[model samples]
Target: MLQYLNPSSAYEALLEFLAAGGNVLVVIMFVAFFMWALIIERIIFWTTAKDGVIKRAKRAWAARTDHKSWYAHAIRDRLISEAKQETERFNGIIRALVAVTPLLGLLGTVTGMVEVFDIMAVTGSSNARLMAGGISKATIPTMAGLVVSLSGLIFINAFERFAKKAEHEVSDELLIE
Candidate 1:
Protein backbone atom coordinates (compact mmCIF):
# COMPACT_ATOMS: atom_id res chain seq x y z
CA MET A 1 0.00 0.00 0.00
CA LEU A 2 2.78 2.42 0.89
CA GLN A 3 4.55 1.55 -2.35
CA TYR A 4 1.43 2.44 -4.30
CA LEU A 5 1.34 5.89 -2.72
CA ASN A 6 4.87 6.76 -3.91
CA PRO A 7 4.52 8.49 -7.24
CA SER A 8 8.24 8.70 -7.91
CA SER A 9 8.65 4.97 -7.34
CA ALA A 10 5.82 4.19 -9.74
CA TYR A 11 7.20 6.56 -12.33
CA GLU A 12 10.65 5.10 -12.03
CA ALA A 13 9.26 1.62 -12.37
CA LEU A 14 7.35 2.53 -15.47
CA LEU A 15 10.44 4.11 -17.02
CA GLU A 16 12.49 1.06 -16.23
CA PHE A 17 9.87 -1.22 -17.74
CA LEU A 18 9.72 0.84 -20.92
CA ALA A 19 13.45 0.91 -21.20
CA ALA A 20 13.61 -2.85 -20.92
CA GLY A 21 11.01 -3.28 -23.65
CA GLY A 22 12.95 -1.28 -26.28
CA ASN A 23 11.67 0.92 -29.11
CA VAL A 24 8.88 -1.41 -30.15
CA LEU A 25 7.33 -0.99 -26.74
CA VAL A 26 7.32 2.76 -27.26
CA VAL A 27 5.40 2.36 -30.50
CA ILE A 28 2.93 0.06 -28.78
CA MET A 29 2.53 2.64 -26.02
CA PHE A 30 1.64 5.38 -28.49
CA VAL A 31 -0.79 3.15 -30.32
CA ALA A 32 -2.46 2.15 -27.05
CA PHE A 33 -2.68 5.76 -25.98
CA PHE A 34 -4.45 6.89 -29.13
CA MET A 35 -6.65 3.81 -29.21
CA TRP A 36 -7.77 4.48 -25.66
CA ALA A 37 -8.39 8.13 -26.47
CA LEU A 38 -10.67 7.20 -29.34
CA ILE A 39 -12.48 4.66 -27.18
CA ILE A 40 -13.15 7.27 -24.52
CA GLU A 41 -14.36 9.69 -27.15
CA ARG A 42 -16.82 7.15 -28.48
CA ILE A 43 -18.08 6.44 -24.98
CA ILE A 44 -18.62 10.14 -24.40
CA PHE A 45 -20.45 10.49 -27.70
CA TRP A 46 -22.69 7.56 -26.91
CA THR A 47 -23.61 9.09 -23.58
CA THR A 48 -24.07 12.66 -24.81
CA ALA A 49 -24.70 12.69 -28.56
CA LYS A 50 -26.79 9.57 -28.90
CA ASP A 51 -30.03 11.06 -27.65
CA GLY A 52 -29.59 14.42 -29.32
CA VAL A 53 -29.04 12.78 -32.69
CA ILE A 54 -31.98 10.48 -32.21
CA LYS A 55 -34.22 13.36 -31.19
CA ARG A 56 -33.20 15.39 -34.18
CA ALA A 57 -33.81 12.50 -36.54
CA LYS A 58 -37.15 11.85 -34.92
CA ARG A 59 -38.13 15.50 -35.29
CA ALA A 60 -37.15 15.49 -38.95
CA TRP A 61 -39.02 12.25 -39.45
CA ALA A 62 -42.15 13.56 -37.67
CA ALA A 63 -42.29 16.67 -39.85
CA ARG A 64 -42.87 14.62 -42.96
CA THR A 65 -46.40 14.98 -44.43
CA ASP A 66 -46.38 12.21 -47.01
CA HIS A 67 -45.08 9.10 -45.30
CA LYS A 68 -46.43 6.74 -47.97
CA SER A 69 -45.01 8.39 -51.06
CA TRP A 70 -41.78 7.12 -52.70
CA TYR A 71 -39.99 10.39 -51.98
CA ALA A 72 -41.00 10.18 -48.33
CA HIS A 73 -39.64 6.66 -48.18
CA ALA A 74 -36.35 7.91 -49.54
CA ILE A 75 -36.25 10.63 -46.90
CA ARG A 76 -36.88 8.07 -44.17
CA ASP A 77 -34.07 5.91 -45.55
CA ARG A 78 -31.80 8.93 -45.61
CA LEU A 79 -32.56 9.69 -41.98
CA ILE A 80 -31.84 6.14 -40.98
CA SER A 81 -28.61 6.14 -42.95
CA GLU A 82 -27.52 9.36 -41.31
CA ALA A 83 -28.27 8.00 -37.86
CA LYS A 84 -26.30 4.83 -38.57
CA GLN A 85 -23.39 6.86 -39.85
CA GLU A 86 -23.39 8.96 -36.74
CA THR A 87 -23.63 5.95 -34.43
CA GLU A 88 -20.95 3.95 -36.24
CA ARG A 89 -18.53 6.84 -36.63
CA PHE A 90 -14.89 5.92 -36.02
CA ASN A 91 -15.73 2.28 -35.25
CA GLY A 92 -13.89 0.94 -38.30
CA ILE A 93 -10.76 2.84 -37.36
CA ILE A 94 -11.06 1.63 -33.80
CA ARG A 95 -11.18 -1.97 -35.00
CA ALA A 96 -8.26 -1.43 -37.30
CA LEU A 97 -6.21 0.04 -34.50
CA VAL A 98 -7.09 -2.87 -32.27
CA ALA A 99 -6.11 -5.32 -34.97
CA VAL A 100 -2.81 -3.53 -35.60
CA THR A 101 -1.73 -3.72 -31.97
CA PRO A 102 -1.13 -7.46 -31.94
CA LEU A 103 0.65 -7.34 -35.28
CA LEU A 104 2.99 -4.72 -33.90
CA GLY A 105 3.66 -7.03 -30.99
CA LEU A 106 4.46 -9.78 -33.47
CA LEU A 107 6.92 -7.48 -35.16
CA GLY A 108 8.57 -6.85 -31.82
CA THR A 109 8.80 -10.58 -31.33
CA VAL A 110 10.58 -11.02 -34.66
CA THR A 111 13.09 -8.25 -33.93
CA GLY A 112 13.84 -9.68 -30.53
CA MET A 113 14.37 -13.13 -31.98
CA VAL A 114 16.79 -11.69 -34.50
CA GLU A 115 18.73 -10.10 -31.67
CA VAL A 116 18.84 -13.43 -29.86
CA PHE A 117 20.10 -15.24 -32.94
CA ASP A 118 22.77 -12.61 -33.54
CA ILE A 119 24.01 -13.00 -29.99
CA MET A 120 24.10 -16.76 -30.40
CA ALA A 121 26.09 -16.49 -33.63
CA VAL A 122 28.70 -14.22 -32.05
CA THR A 123 29.15 -15.89 -28.67
CA GLY A 124 29.16 -19.44 -30.16
CA SER A 125 27.22 -20.56 -27.06
CA SER A 126 24.08 -19.71 -25.11
CA ASN A 127 24.71 -17.08 -22.45
CA ALA A 128 21.79 -16.20 -20.17
CA ARG A 129 22.85 -12.63 -19.44
CA LEU A 130 23.71 -11.92 -23.06
CA MET A 131 20.40 -13.38 -24.19
CA ALA A 132 18.15 -11.84 -21.56
CA GLY A 133 17.82 -8.57 -23.45
CA GLY A 134 16.46 -10.26 -26.56
CA ILE A 135 14.12 -12.45 -24.54
CA SER A 136 12.63 -9.50 -22.67
CA LYS A 137 12.25 -7.48 -25.85
CA ALA A 138 10.52 -10.34 -27.59
CA THR A 139 8.07 -10.97 -24.74
CA ILE A 140 7.33 -7.47 -23.46
CA PRO A 141 5.95 -6.00 -26.67
CA THR A 142 3.86 -9.09 -27.33
CA MET A 143 2.36 -8.80 -23.85
CA ALA A 144 1.84 -5.08 -24.19
CA GLY A 145 0.22 -5.41 -27.61
CA LEU A 146 -2.11 -8.17 -26.53
CA VAL A 147 -3.07 -6.25 -23.39
CA VAL A 148 -3.76 -3.11 -25.39
CA SER A 149 -5.72 -4.97 -28.04
CA LEU A 150 -7.87 -6.87 -25.53
CA SER A 151 -8.65 -3.73 -23.58
CA GLY A 152 -9.63 -1.96 -26.79
CA LEU A 153 -11.66 -4.95 -27.88
CA ILE A 154 -14.03 -4.63 -24.93
CA PHE A 155 -14.79 -0.99 -25.64
CA ILE A 156 -15.06 -1.56 -29.39
CA ASN A 157 -17.63 -4.30 -28.93
CA ALA A 158 -19.56 -2.19 -26.47
CA PHE A 159 -19.55 0.77 -28.86
CA GLU A 160 -20.68 -1.40 -31.75
CA ARG A 161 -23.52 -2.86 -29.71
CA PHE A 162 -24.52 0.56 -28.45
CA ALA A 163 -24.57 1.92 -31.99
CA LYS A 164 -26.69 -1.00 -33.19
CA LYS A 165 -29.16 -0.57 -30.37
CA ALA A 166 -29.25 3.18 -30.83
CA GLU A 167 -29.90 2.72 -34.52
CA HIS A 168 -32.80 0.43 -33.74
CA GLU A 169 -34.21 2.88 -31.21
CA VAL A 170 -33.97 5.71 -33.72
CA SER A 171 -35.64 3.58 -36.40
CA ASP A 172 -38.48 2.73 -34.06
CA GLU A 173 -38.90 6.39 -33.24
CA LEU A 174 -39.18 7.16 -36.95
CA LEU A 175 -42.22 4.87 -37.32
CA ILE A 176 -42.27 3.59 -40.90
CA GLU A 177 -45.43 4.17 -42.96
Candidate 2:
Protein backbone atom coordinates (compact mmCIF):
# COMPACT_ATOMS: atom_id res chain seq x y z
CA MET A 1 0.00 0.00 0.00
CA LEU A 2 2.77 2.43 0.91
CA GLN A 3 4.92 1.49 -2.05
CA TYR A 4 2.10 2.00 -4.51
CA LEU A 5 1.51 5.51 -3.27
CA ASN A 6 5.25 6.31 -3.19
CA PRO A 7 5.77 4.93 -6.71
CA SER A 8 8.63 2.53 -5.85
CA SER A 9 10.89 5.14 -4.27
CA ALA A 10 12.58 3.55 -1.24
CA TYR A 11 13.12 6.84 0.59
CA GLU A 12 9.58 7.92 0.10
CA ALA A 13 8.34 4.56 1.19
CA LEU A 14 10.41 4.76 4.33
CA LEU A 15 9.07 8.17 5.12
CA GLU A 16 5.56 6.90 4.57
CA PHE A 17 6.27 3.90 6.75
CA LEU A 18 7.45 6.05 9.61
CA ALA A 19 4.67 8.53 9.18
CA ALA A 20 2.05 5.82 9.21
CA GLY A 21 3.73 3.96 12.05
CA GLY A 22 4.63 6.96 14.17
CA ASN A 23 2.19 6.71 17.03
CA VAL A 24 2.09 2.94 17.65
CA LEU A 25 5.77 2.27 16.95
CA VAL A 26 6.84 4.83 19.53
CA VAL A 27 6.46 2.28 22.33
CA ILE A 28 8.77 -0.13 20.54
CA MET A 29 11.35 2.60 20.03
CA PHE A 30 11.35 3.45 23.71
CA VAL A 31 11.83 -0.15 24.73
CA ALA A 32 14.60 -0.54 22.18
CA PHE A 33 16.41 2.48 23.56
CA PHE A 34 16.13 1.16 27.10
CA MET A 35 17.47 -2.22 26.05
CA TRP A 36 20.28 -0.57 24.09
CA ALA A 37 21.29 1.46 27.10
CA LEU A 38 21.38 -1.61 29.27
CA ILE A 39 23.49 -3.47 26.77
CA ILE A 40 26.00 -0.67 26.46
CA GLU A 41 26.14 -0.12 30.21
CA ARG A 42 26.79 -3.79 30.80
CA ILE A 43 29.52 -3.81 28.22
CA ILE A 44 31.34 -0.96 29.90
CA PHE A 45 30.60 -2.29 33.36
CA TRP A 46 31.72 -5.87 32.74
CA THR A 47 34.87 -4.70 31.04
CA THR A 48 35.76 -2.89 34.24
CA ALA A 49 34.35 -5.60 36.44
CA LYS A 50 36.66 -8.28 35.09
CA ASP A 51 39.70 -6.11 34.47
CA GLY A 52 41.43 -6.13 37.84
CA VAL A 53 39.15 -8.36 39.88
CA ILE A 54 41.03 -11.54 39.34
CA LYS A 55 44.42 -9.87 39.28
CA ARG A 56 43.49 -8.30 42.57
CA ALA A 57 42.34 -11.71 43.68
CA LYS A 58 45.64 -13.31 42.69
CA ARG A 59 47.58 -10.66 44.57
CA ALA A 60 45.35 -11.17 47.55
CA TRP A 61 45.84 -14.92 47.21
CA ALA A 62 49.62 -14.56 47.03
CA ALA A 63 49.34 -12.28 50.03
CA ARG A 64 47.34 -14.96 51.76
CA THR A 65 44.18 -12.84 52.08
CA ASP A 66 42.12 -15.84 50.85
CA HIS A 67 41.50 -14.39 47.40
CA LYS A 68 39.54 -17.34 46.07
CA SER A 69 36.33 -16.47 47.94
CA TRP A 70 36.31 -12.83 46.93
CA TYR A 71 37.60 -13.64 43.45
CA ALA A 72 34.89 -16.25 43.07
CA HIS A 73 32.17 -13.79 43.98
CA ALA A 74 33.55 -11.21 41.60
CA ILE A 75 33.81 -13.78 38.84
CA ARG A 76 30.31 -15.01 39.55
CA ASP A 77 29.01 -11.48 39.22
CA ARG A 78 30.84 -11.12 35.92
CA LEU A 79 29.29 -14.32 34.56
CA ILE A 80 32.54 -15.61 33.18
CA SER A 81 31.67 -18.89 31.49
CA GLU A 82 35.32 -20.02 31.30
CA ALA A 83 35.52 -20.42 35.03
CA LYS A 84 33.77 -23.21 36.92
CA GLN A 85 29.96 -23.19 37.14
CA GLU A 86 30.37 -21.00 40.19
CA THR A 87 31.53 -18.12 38.02
CA GLU A 88 28.42 -18.16 35.86
CA ARG A 89 25.92 -17.27 38.55
CA PHE A 90 24.97 -13.92 37.14
CA ASN A 91 23.61 -15.52 33.97
CA GLY A 92 20.27 -15.61 35.70
CA ILE A 93 19.99 -11.82 35.61
CA ILE A 94 20.54 -11.74 31.86
CA ARG A 95 18.09 -14.55 31.33
CA ALA A 96 15.56 -12.74 33.46
CA LEU A 97 16.01 -9.42 31.67
CA VAL A 98 15.72 -10.91 28.21
CA ALA A 99 12.85 -13.22 29.11
CA VAL A 100 10.76 -10.60 30.86
CA THR A 101 10.82 -8.05 28.04
CA PRO A 102 9.30 -10.44 25.54
CA LEU A 103 6.50 -11.28 27.93
CA LEU A 104 5.84 -7.57 28.30
CA GLY A 105 5.64 -7.35 24.53
CA LEU A 106 3.18 -10.21 24.62
CA LEU A 107 1.19 -8.31 27.19
CA GLY A 108 1.07 -5.36 24.83
CA THR A 109 -0.27 -7.68 22.18
CA VAL A 110 -3.04 -8.86 24.47
CA THR A 111 -4.06 -5.41 25.48
CA GLY A 112 -3.94 -4.22 21.90
CA MET A 113 -6.17 -7.10 20.86
CA VAL A 114 -8.61 -6.30 23.59
CA GLU A 115 -8.81 -2.77 22.27
CA VAL A 116 -9.26 -4.16 18.76
CA PHE A 117 -12.15 -6.29 19.95
CA ASP A 118 -13.70 -3.32 21.59
CA ILE A 119 -13.39 -1.45 18.33
CA MET A 120 -14.87 -4.39 16.47
CA ALA A 121 -17.84 -4.75 18.78
CA VAL A 122 -18.63 -1.12 18.37
CA THR A 123 -18.17 -1.02 14.60
CA GLY A 124 -18.96 -4.64 13.57
CA SER A 125 -16.58 -5.15 10.62
CA SER A 126 -13.00 -6.17 9.70
CA ASN A 127 -12.32 -3.09 7.67
CA ALA A 128 -8.61 -2.58 6.99
CA ARG A 129 -8.54 0.98 8.21
CA LEU A 130 -10.52 0.11 11.31
CA MET A 131 -8.48 -2.97 12.21
CA ALA A 132 -5.04 -1.55 11.40
CA GLY A 133 -4.75 0.41 14.62
CA GLY A 134 -5.24 -2.58 16.92
CA ILE A 135 -3.08 -4.89 14.85
CA SER A 136 -0.26 -2.37 14.72
CA LYS A 137 -0.35 -1.87 18.45
CA ALA A 138 -0.25 -5.61 19.02
CA THR A 139 2.55 -6.53 16.60
CA ILE A 140 4.83 -3.53 17.03
CA PRO A 141 5.44 -4.05 20.73
CA THR A 142 6.31 -7.72 20.26
CA MET A 143 8.81 -6.95 17.52
CA ALA A 144 10.36 -4.19 19.57
CA GLY A 145 10.60 -6.38 22.65
CA LEU A 146 12.19 -9.22 20.75
CA VAL A 147 14.69 -6.93 19.08
CA VAL A 148 15.73 -5.48 22.41
CA SER A 149 15.82 -8.85 24.15
CA LEU A 150 17.75 -10.64 21.43
CA SER A 151 20.32 -7.89 20.90
CA GLY A 152 20.89 -7.55 24.62
CA LEU A 153 21.25 -11.32 25.03
CA ILE A 154 23.81 -11.58 22.24
CA PHE A 155 26.00 -8.78 23.54
CA ILE A 156 25.74 -10.04 27.13
CA ASN A 157 26.76 -13.56 26.14
CA ALA A 158 29.72 -12.27 24.20
CA PHE A 159 30.76 -10.18 27.18
CA GLU A 160 30.41 -13.26 29.34
CA ARG A 161 32.96 -15.06 27.20
CA PHE A 162 35.44 -12.21 27.49
CA ALA A 163 34.87 -12.10 31.23
CA LYS A 164 35.64 -15.81 31.43
CA LYS A 165 39.11 -15.25 30.02
CA ALA A 166 39.78 -12.60 32.61
CA GLU A 167 38.48 -14.88 35.36
CA HIS A 168 40.68 -17.75 34.25
CA GLU A 169 43.73 -15.53 34.13
CA VAL A 170 43.07 -14.45 37.68
CA SER A 171 42.41 -17.96 38.86
CA ASP A 172 45.57 -19.34 37.29
CA GLU A 173 47.73 -16.54 38.61
CA LEU A 174 46.28 -16.92 42.09
CA LEU A 175 46.62 -20.69 42.50
CA ILE A 176 48.52 -21.66 45.61
CA GLU A 177 51.78 -23.61 45.54
Candidate 3:
Protein backbone atom coordinates (compact mmCIF):
# COMPACT_ATOMS: atom_id res chain seq x y z
CA MET A 1 0.00 0.00 0.00
CA LEU A 2 1.08 3.61 -0.57
CA GLN A 3 0.56 4.25 3.14
CA TYR A 4 3.16 1.60 3.98
CA LEU A 5 5.56 3.12 1.46
CA ASN A 6 5.16 6.61 2.84
CA PRO A 7 8.27 7.51 4.84
CA SER A 8 6.41 9.60 7.40
CA SER A 9 3.93 6.81 8.03
CA ALA A 10 6.74 4.31 8.39
CA TYR A 11 8.52 6.59 10.82
CA GLU A 12 5.38 7.01 12.88
CA ALA A 13 4.85 3.27 12.91
CA LEU A 14 8.43 2.68 14.03
CA LEU A 15 8.10 5.22 16.82
CA GLU A 16 4.90 3.62 17.99
CA PHE A 17 6.49 0.19 17.91
CA LEU A 18 9.45 1.39 19.95
CA ALA A 19 7.15 3.01 22.44
CA ALA A 20 5.23 -0.24 22.87
CA GLY A 21 8.46 -2.21 23.29
CA GLY A 22 9.40 0.00 26.24
CA ASN A 23 12.81 1.04 27.55
CA VAL A 24 14.69 -2.17 26.77
CA LEU A 25 14.14 -1.57 23.08
CA VAL A 26 16.30 1.53 23.44
CA VAL A 27 19.25 -0.57 24.63
CA ILE A 28 18.67 -3.02 21.80
CA MET A 29 18.62 -0.10 19.37
CA PHE A 30 22.04 1.10 20.51
CA VAL A 31 23.51 -2.42 20.45
CA ALA A 32 22.19 -3.04 16.94
CA PHE A 33 23.57 0.33 15.82
CA PHE A 34 27.02 -0.43 17.20
CA MET A 35 27.05 -3.95 15.77
CA TRP A 36 26.04 -2.70 12.33
CA ALA A 37 28.66 0.04 12.46
CA LEU A 38 31.40 -2.48 13.14
CA ILE A 39 30.05 -4.74 10.40
CA ILE A 40 30.15 -1.86 7.94
CA GLU A 41 33.69 -0.97 9.02
CA ARG A 42 34.88 -4.52 8.42
CA ILE A 43 33.14 -4.59 5.02
CA ILE A 44 34.85 -1.34 4.11
CA PHE A 45 38.20 -2.68 5.23
CA TRP A 46 37.75 -5.82 3.16
CA THR A 47 36.77 -3.87 0.05
CA THR A 48 39.42 -1.16 0.34
CA ALA A 49 42.27 -2.06 2.69
CA LYS A 50 42.43 -5.85 2.42
CA ASP A 51 44.01 -5.87 -1.04
CA GLY A 52 46.72 -3.43 0.01
CA VAL A 53 47.69 -5.64 2.92
CA ILE A 54 47.74 -8.71 0.71
CA LYS A 55 49.85 -6.91 -1.87
CA ARG A 56 52.31 -5.73 0.75
CA ALA A 57 52.77 -9.21 2.14
CA LYS A 58 53.17 -10.68 -1.31
CA ARG A 59 55.66 -8.00 -2.23
CA ALA A 60 57.66 -8.68 0.90
CA TRP A 61 57.68 -12.38 0.14
CA ALA A 62 58.66 -11.76 -3.47
CA ALA A 63 61.55 -9.51 -2.52
CA ARG A 64 63.16 -12.32 -0.59
CA THR A 65 65.86 -14.12 -2.53
CA ASP A 66 66.16 -16.89 0.07
CA HIS A 67 62.84 -18.73 0.24
CA LYS A 68 63.95 -22.15 1.47
CA SER A 69 65.74 -21.11 4.69
CA TRP A 70 64.20 -21.46 8.17
CA TYR A 71 64.30 -17.69 8.54
CA ALA A 72 62.35 -17.31 5.34
CA HIS A 73 59.63 -19.60 6.66
CA ALA A 74 59.51 -17.60 9.88
CA ILE A 75 59.11 -14.38 7.93
CA ARG A 76 56.34 -15.99 5.92
CA ASP A 77 54.52 -17.01 9.06
CA ARG A 78 54.81 -13.52 10.45
CA LEU A 79 53.37 -11.99 7.29
CA ILE A 80 50.44 -14.38 7.39
CA SER A 81 49.89 -13.58 11.06
CA GLU A 82 49.85 -9.88 10.34
CA ALA A 83 47.35 -10.33 7.58
CA LYS A 84 45.17 -12.51 9.82
CA GLN A 85 45.21 -9.99 12.61
CA GLU A 86 44.30 -7.12 10.31
CA THR A 87 41.45 -9.00 8.73
CA GLU A 88 40.11 -10.18 12.08
CA ARG A 89 40.05 -6.88 13.90
CA PHE A 90 36.83 -6.01 15.72
CA ASN A 91 35.39 -9.46 14.96
CA GLY A 92 35.45 -10.55 18.58
CA ILE A 93 33.61 -7.46 19.74
CA ILE A 94 31.06 -7.80 16.99
CA ARG A 95 30.44 -11.41 17.95
CA ALA A 96 30.09 -10.51 21.61
CA LEU A 97 27.54 -7.86 20.78
CA VAL A 98 25.61 -10.33 18.70
CA ALA A 99 25.59 -12.79 21.58
CA VAL A 100 24.43 -10.15 24.05
CA THR A 101 21.39 -8.93 22.12
CA PRO A 102 19.27 -11.98 22.90
CA LEU A 103 20.15 -11.71 26.55
CA LEU A 104 19.07 -8.10 26.56
CA GLY A 105 15.78 -9.19 25.08
CA LEU A 106 15.40 -11.69 27.90
CA LEU A 107 15.93 -8.90 30.36
CA GLY A 108 13.18 -6.95 28.63
CA THR A 109 10.89 -9.95 28.94
CA VAL A 110 11.51 -10.21 32.67
CA THR A 111 10.96 -6.50 33.23
CA GLY A 112 7.75 -6.56 31.24
CA MET A 113 6.40 -9.60 33.11
CA VAL A 114 7.26 -7.89 36.34
CA GLU A 115 5.26 -4.92 35.13
CA VAL A 116 2.32 -7.18 34.36
CA PHE A 117 2.48 -8.74 37.81
CA ASP A 118 2.64 -5.30 39.39
CA ILE A 119 -0.48 -4.20 37.59
CA MET A 120 -2.23 -7.37 38.67
CA ALA A 121 -1.21 -6.75 42.28
CA VAL A 122 -2.47 -3.17 42.16
CA THR A 123 -5.70 -3.95 40.37
CA GLY A 124 -6.45 -7.17 42.24
CA SER A 125 -8.04 -8.55 39.08
CA SER A 126 -7.02 -10.03 35.72
CA ASN A 127 -7.43 -7.01 33.44
CA ALA A 128 -6.63 -7.92 29.88
CA ARG A 129 -6.70 -4.30 28.69
CA LEU A 130 -4.07 -3.20 31.24
CA MET A 131 -1.95 -6.34 30.76
CA ALA A 132 -1.78 -5.89 27.00
CA GLY A 133 0.93 -3.26 27.33
CA GLY A 134 3.09 -5.56 29.45
CA ILE A 135 2.58 -8.48 27.07
CA SER A 136 3.61 -6.36 24.08
CA LYS A 137 6.66 -5.14 25.93
CA ALA A 138 7.71 -8.67 26.74
CA THR A 139 7.23 -10.12 23.26
CA ILE A 140 8.34 -7.31 20.97
CA PRO A 141 11.83 -7.08 22.43
CA THR A 142 12.42 -10.82 22.20
CA MET A 143 11.42 -10.72 18.55
CA ALA A 144 13.60 -7.68 17.93
CA GLY A 145 16.58 -9.25 19.65
CA LEU A 146 16.19 -12.47 17.69
CA VAL A 147 15.88 -10.53 14.43
CA VAL A 148 19.03 -8.54 15.16
CA SER A 149 20.98 -11.60 16.27
CA LEU A 150 20.06 -13.62 13.19
CA SER A 151 20.99 -10.79 10.83
CA GLY A 152 24.29 -10.19 12.62
CA LEU A 153 25.11 -13.89 12.65
CA ILE A 154 24.69 -14.04 8.89
CA PHE A 155 27.16 -11.21 8.29
CA ILE A 156 29.62 -12.42 10.92
CA ASN A 157 29.74 -15.87 9.40
CA ALA A 158 30.25 -14.43 5.92
CA PHE A 159 33.08 -12.19 7.10
CA GLU A 160 34.69 -15.06 8.98
CA ARG A 161 34.60 -17.26 5.92
CA PHE A 162 36.12 -14.46 3.88
CA ALA A 163 38.87 -13.96 6.45
CA LYS A 164 39.75 -17.64 6.44
CA LYS A 165 39.78 -17.77 2.67
CA ALA A 166 41.93 -14.66 2.52
CA GLU A 167 44.37 -16.14 5.00
CA HIS A 168 44.68 -19.32 2.99
CA GLU A 169 45.09 -17.33 -0.23
CA VAL A 170 47.79 -15.18 1.30
CA SER A 171 49.59 -18.22 2.61
CA ASP A 172 49.38 -19.83 -0.80
CA GLU A 173 50.74 -16.72 -2.45
CA LEU A 174 53.67 -16.62 -0.04
CA LEU A 175 54.74 -20.13 -1.03
CA ILE A 176 58.21 -21.37 -0.07
CA GLU A 177 59.98 -21.85 -3.36
Q: Candidate 3: lDDT of 40?
A: 97
Candidates by TM-score, descending order: 1, 3, 2
Clashes of 3: 0
What clash count goes with each model?
Answer: 0, 0, 0
Instruction: Provide the global lDDT of candidate 1 against the true structure.
Output: 0.91
Error of 1 at 124 (Å): 2.1
Q: Considering only N, C-alpha and C atoms within 3 Å, which residue pairs clash in candidate 3?
A: none
* lDDT of every model, 2 decimals: 0.91, 0.63, 0.93
The residue-by-residue lDDT of candidate 2 on 7-98, one tens digit each, is 55876765565444444455555655665666666666665655555555555445555435766556433433333343344455665667
74: Cα error in model 1, Å:
0.7
Model 2 poorest 10 in a row by lDDT = 78-87
Ranking by lDDT: 3, 1, 2
Best candidate according to TM-score: 1
TM-scores for all candidates?
A: 0.94, 0.64, 0.93
Report the poorest 10 consecutive residues by lDDT, candidate 1.
168-177
Clashing pairs in 1: none
Error of 2 at 47 (Å): 3.8
Query: In candidate 1, how many Å is residue 3 off?
Result: 3.6
Candidate topping lDDT: 3
